[model samples]
Target: MGKSGQFIKRWKSLSYDGKVIFLKSAVCLLLIKTGLTLLPFLQFRRLFHRITETSTVKEVSPQQIELTVWAVDTAANLLPFELLCLPRALAAKYLLRKVPSLTLEIGIEVNPAKHFEAHAWVENNGTVIMGKWPESVSYHRLWAWK
Candidate 1:
């Protein structure tokens, strides 16, 4: 079958909960992508903080965390525009807002070309749930939010 058929088949194969998570992730990613384009960094940070604050703290299972990561990554892949690591990480944070142990970290590194690069990732209980890079260890963590 063609790509569209494959996509439809994949969509049909997902469980109801999986489908919900995927849809939520897609919308969250799209919003974050657009927000990043229109808002200043500080203003967006405040908006994100307000959004996350609405969720009551609750203990989250590892399976739930994994599902959140999978949904965000899959949705990011299917999106028409490319999503950078920050937006993906932010989307994961939004999905995992109820987890008190959730942490969002920003890191920086100097590339071989002497260009400074930044990366963002979400971690739960010290384990990275999104934005894991091949040279993840090389990036110096600049900030972390819990």
Candidate 2:
């Protein structure tokens, strides 16, 4: 089977809620990617904050968080263009906006090769919900937003 056919099969295998989550992740990724291109960082963040703000805070299960991570990761992979860590973090934040414990974190590191790198991730109640990798522990946390 072709890549398109495999993609369709994988997509069709998802349950209804999974499908919804995937769609949300894909849309959020597109919006954040575009927003980052067109707007200043601060302005785009403020707009994103306003858009994702929720009146009521709710607690969600670990499984829900896992599902969200899966959705975001899967959506990012399926996109024709790359969606970097910052956009992925922002997208997860949008999905988990109602969760009061959610936080967006940025970390930086200077590699042995003398290259500076940065990463973004989201955490809920002190546990990383997205953007974690084996090297993630090496990064020094620069900032976080709740």
Candidate 3:
């Protein structure tokens, strides 16, 4: 069977709640991508903050949160445009329960030739929830936000 057929089959195998979560992830990814593309940096950040703030956070297991994050990350990666770490992290934060202590972190590294480089990632209880945390070790942490 073709990839599209396989995808449909796989999608059909998920439970109703899983499907809903996946759909939400896809929509959030599209919105984040579009907002980043069309709005100024501060405006996009404000909009993103408002959306996340307004989402209803429910009680969910750690494993369920992990699954949601993985699904959202996968969907975000498949988008046509470059989806950066901040949006992906925000999407995970939006889907997770409000009490898990997840943090969005930004780091920077000074390169002798290239001036500097920056990276963003999310962490939960010191464990990396998303982005390249292992690779981020070379970067000096600049700031973090809840």
Off by over 4 Å in 2: 1-10, 110-113, 135-137
lDDT of 3 by residue, 1-146 (tens): 97557657768888888888888888887877788789998998787777666444456777777768867876776667777787787777767637447777888865566667787788887788788655534767788766
RMSD of each: 2.4, 2.3, 3.1
* Higher-ranked by TM-score: 1 or 3: 1
Query: What's each prediction's TM-score?
Result: 0.87, 0.87, 0.78
Best by lDDT: 2
lDDT score at residue 128, model 2, on the 0-100 scale: 82
lDDT per residue as tens, model 1, 1-146? 97558667877988898789889999999999999999999999999988888547788778778878988987898899999899999999998889888899998875576588899999877877798877534778999976
Q: How many residue pairs clash in all the candidates, one count each?
A: 0, 0, 0
Candidate 3 is scored at a TM of 0.78
lDDT of each: 0.87, 0.87, 0.74
